[model samples]
Target: MPNVVLLLAALAFAGCDVFESSEPVAFTRIALPARPVLVNGTTVVRGDYQLSAFTRSVNDSLISVPTIDFDRQTVLGVFYGGSFHAGCRGNVETIEGIRLAGDALIVEVGPLPDLGPCRAIVYPSDMVVVNARATSVRFVGAVPQ
Candidate 1:
């Protein structure tokens, strides 16, 4: 039994790839729905996702969230209307860690700035915020931006 354990450990250690990557991972922008929120099976942006920032500038509070969209279901808009980046979070910053593995789209979102200084905006047109990064996102395809 102990010999088997030692053999497994040795194999795992030998499989480590120290030279796997040498470049910074870029989180490519994903194509999402104009109304991409999915509550149960219906599309609706609720909870923390129900947010808005008036100006699409760095001065605005960062909308740091994981986005989930339908590949064939959510109607893809040719033009994206809003802008929210880590630059907007002032002292704090956010990064939507969008990744592509095989056909999966992974998003690892950092923390967001406090909503105190943020001037509240309504949903729909004003709701041009990024989907706050959830625990995990299961997706496919890629749109580098």
Candidate 2:
């Protein structure tokens, strides 16, 4: 009986470490819009913001979602979940001082304050056929419709 009690106590203590060391899953992908999108009434070139990828990190509770952007070789933007203080619930708000290469389109999230560059690739599953003009570009499986 005493051994069983000790084992239970040890198991309970170990569970706390499970949440402590686990990092949130970060999703990275390149998203292309169906059609050309206009930013501030300006028609953004097709390839200008096309090859961009983003990484978003979510907490264990799935409340706040912070995103970071990597455009070919530059960090475009960083947005935090300020409005959704309880959990991950708000859209990415761009961080100032960081300029996206060419035009602003896709963004991502990171743990540090530095953006890393990476090559962009369009996946087969990400291709979508649409007739209307696209307004924004996002990472695959990152943005919610």
- TM-score against native, each model: 0.27, 0.21
lDDT of 2 at 69: 27
**Candidate 1 residues 50-110, lDDT tens each?**
3232113223444343454422211111111233322212222233344443333343334
What is the per-residue lDDT of model 2 for residues 1-145, given as tens digits with 9 covering 90 to 100?
Answer: 9999999999999897654441222233224322212121111223323323121121122322223222223222222222212222122222212212223333332222212233322111122111122345333223222
Best by TM-score: 1
- The clash numbers for all candidates, in the given order, read 6, 10
lDDT measured at residue 31 in model 2 versus the true structure, 0 to 100: 41
Kindly provide the TM-score of model 2 when superposed on the true structure, using C-alpha atoms. Answer: 0.21
Measured over all alpha carbons after superposition, the RMSD of each candidate to the real structure, in angstroms, is 13.0, 18.2
Worst 10 residues of 2 by lDDT: 122-131
Q: After superposition, how far is residue 53 of candidate 1 from its true place, in Å?
A: 22
Q: Where does model 1 exceed 4 Å of error?
A: 1-10, 13-94, 116-145
